[model samples]
Target: MRKEIFSKKIMDWYQANHRNLPWRKTTEPYKIWLSEIILQQTRVAQGLPYYERFVGAFPDVLDLAKAPVQKVLRLWQGLGYYTRARNLHRCAKLVVRDFEGHFPNSFEGLKKLPGIGPYTAAAIASIAFREPVGVVDGNVFRVLARIFGIDKDIASDAGKKYFFSLANELLDEAHPDIFNQAVMEFGALHCLPKNPKCDGCTFSKQCEANQKDLQSLLPVKHKKLKIRTRYFYYFIVRDKNKMLLKQRNGKDIWQGLYDFYLIETSRRKKTAEVVKTDAILTKASILKESRVFRHLLSHQKLLVKFVELKLHSTKEMNLLARRSELKKFTKPEISNLPKPILIDRYLKANP
Candidate 1:
């Protein structure tokens, strides 16, 4: 198909059927950048509220830069991939300190910001600054691969470059922003990964995958993620209204988040085995043991168990805290600290 025809059809479809997202209504680079980052690896339905909350709390780059990282993380509690929240704060600070609170106007300049990669930079450039660049995301990759019958593995660097080049070639330079939004929207709404609506599609006849009955086969991704199983035994040492909590400082999952005293093992252990493994656990009075909680991440499966312990004396509490290298936090204070979703869920369930 002709490049102009392809872009025109996409734009027409988008004009008729596009969802009215708030970010699409503005040309502000800051808002656009925030929306782009929030929507990364996140669906519109789930990410919309977060975007709104962030905008409400930190209205601009300067506000975000000035806000404390813990406050930012608290706002971003349930949203997994905590690194995004950290980077969002870092990016805001960089824009304020280095760029004078103004987001760079060009793609190259935007790329220098933290968490703004090629796709994000292109999105900010085209949508906010009217830079003629193509935005290649998962939706775009699937749409282009099926329509063009290109079976390159989307996970590979070569496949990414190929699709990006194709998107740029088909870009409507005069209205690159609209064109990019249209194609991405079309891919999201129509050309789905499973059960795509091809009967009423604009390019059903010309779509290579549709004609060849290879809809499920195109947009091939060869990489298979290896899942690792971990066992986490949490000691919830509590006194009256406060609990002992520790901040994760290691280069591991849930960094910068608060949780209880953790004893990770190669295999799941019973309460007795856990108690025998630690001197503090042996001395502390066991209040209750939680049922095993199974949590799954992108590549990690966790079998988590919580052992609640109560201290009868302040001396015992202090000793437990000192031995475990944990600090006491009241319920109100614990509520404000950022924590892993598993920790949050366990707290809510136990409380």
Candidate 2:
């Protein structure tokens, strides 16, 4: 297909049908970068409020850089992939300290910042800086593969290279920002992964997938994720109005988020089996036990049980805290502390 014709069709469709998102209306690199990062592994509907909240709290790069990490993570609560929030904070500081609060204007320069990969850099460069580059996200990948009929495993390095080259080849050099957005939006709205709207598509006749009836087959992605099952027994030790909570450390899931005294086991264990795992819990009074919560992540399946235990005196609470390496937090204090969604949801329902 002719690059001009292809780009023109996409841009025309975009101008008429694109959603009016706040990020699309601006040329500020900071806001653009924020939107891109939030939208990663997230849908537009889910990421929209987070973008608004982040902008409301920290309007610019310097504001984000100077704010406490806890504050950032707090604002980023309930949004999974906590690493993105951490990286967003780090990148903001790098931009402020190194680039004087101004994001790098070019793709290569933006790629130097932490968490800014090639796709993010390309997006910021084209949308904010008007660099002539195409952004190949999942949306773009599906669009290109189906429309152009290129059958390469999107997970493979060779497949990625081919699509990357094709994206640059089809890029509208004069208006890359519009072309990129148009194509991405086209795929998101029209050429869906499951049931694509092929009836009224602009490229209905030209699309290989539409003609060949293979929309689901193209854009082949082979992902081998080893889903590990984990069992968590969380002890919610409470002393009157306060509860003992511990911040997760080390390189594991929910790092830095606050949760209760946890006892992890190889498999599912009963309450008696769990109590035997920790000696500190033997001193406390077991009050209630929550039903099992089956939480699913991309690569992990967690079966969690929260056990509520009440300590008789402040001294006992202190002893539990000392032995368990936790701290006492009032109800209000616990509300302010960052927590994993599982912990937060359990608290909201139980409290």
Candidate 3:
């Protein structure tokens, strides 16, 4: 009876005032999956266009699977977290190859796919497949914690277990899709992370945090992110019309994306010191060195320098060819190469 009342009030509120988003109109798993992936860690306003662009570029799963990884990365350039784009591409191929282009129907099957964690699986399952599981994103976490006055640290394993059980119990079994949307939308629109509208909320009388005046203290976060800084010296190796770029490989950030011949260091090195001591830079004449351009990521801060260099002889080109990472490209091909947004900014400014 309590769950039914809560769901009734939420569904009423939703009908009166839910934002008409593009994804809300579709039940197709492909579109729903794309929206969920794109909106991960991204605000709706920022991610909206990217979703539209992706849908426009790759109309279906097969199109995404067939499209070049570079094209996908290029489309995903400004959006940080290249790993998501890679997984999106990989999942598309998997769906075509393994599932015969159909998304898995069961929650257990959906969770097995790469990048389809609990929240995403629940989201796609409920919105696209009408599964009864609850979706507990940051917004949902805030709403649930405040309503129930749950002070368990959301960053902990125990808190997740508690909330997952609570969320499932609170779900409206009859209309789980509508129930899930209402709760998530309620969190987004009314029960915000900070300064939520508890006074005007319909659940105010039933809300434990409101009755106890512990709204801000309910959703506890114990973890602190350690943001490290990295110094990257990038060489814009120019042989007149041609330039050099390297595909980022290995397990580092921005893997599979194109980058300049980079020399990472523990600390910032002086331009004169690098020019005089570095083996490759000594052979090339330094055309110019740019000021420090800072690119901020969630976990790391990149202090980057774009060092423009010119080759003295055809013999000097052999040194660059010896490098496995370095590959020469004409101006047109360089434009086609999918690079990190940090490198893209330098190219645009220099061009």
Residues 128-173 of candidate 2: C-alpha lDDT, one tens digit per residue: 9999988989999999999999889899999998998999999988
Clashing pairs in 3: none
RMSD of 2: 15.0
TM-score of each: 0.67, 0.67, 0.66
Off by over 4 Å in 2: 225-351
Q: List the residue pairs that clash in candidate 1.
A: none
lDDT of model 3 at position 80:
79
**Residue 323, model 2, lDDT:** 84
Model 1 agreement with the true structure over 1-351: per-residue lDDT tens digits: 889889888899999999999999899999999999998999999999999999999989899999999999999889788999999999999989988999999899999888999999999999999999999999999999998899998998899899999999999999989999998898889999999999989998889999999998988999788999999999888788888999998889999999999999998768888788877678778888889999999999999999888767778888878887899999999999999999999989878
Models ranked on lDDT: 2, 1, 3
Worst 10 residues of 2 by lDDT: 276-285
Error of 1 at 271 (Å): 14
lDDT of each: 0.91, 0.92, 0.87
Pairs of colliding residues, candidate 2: none
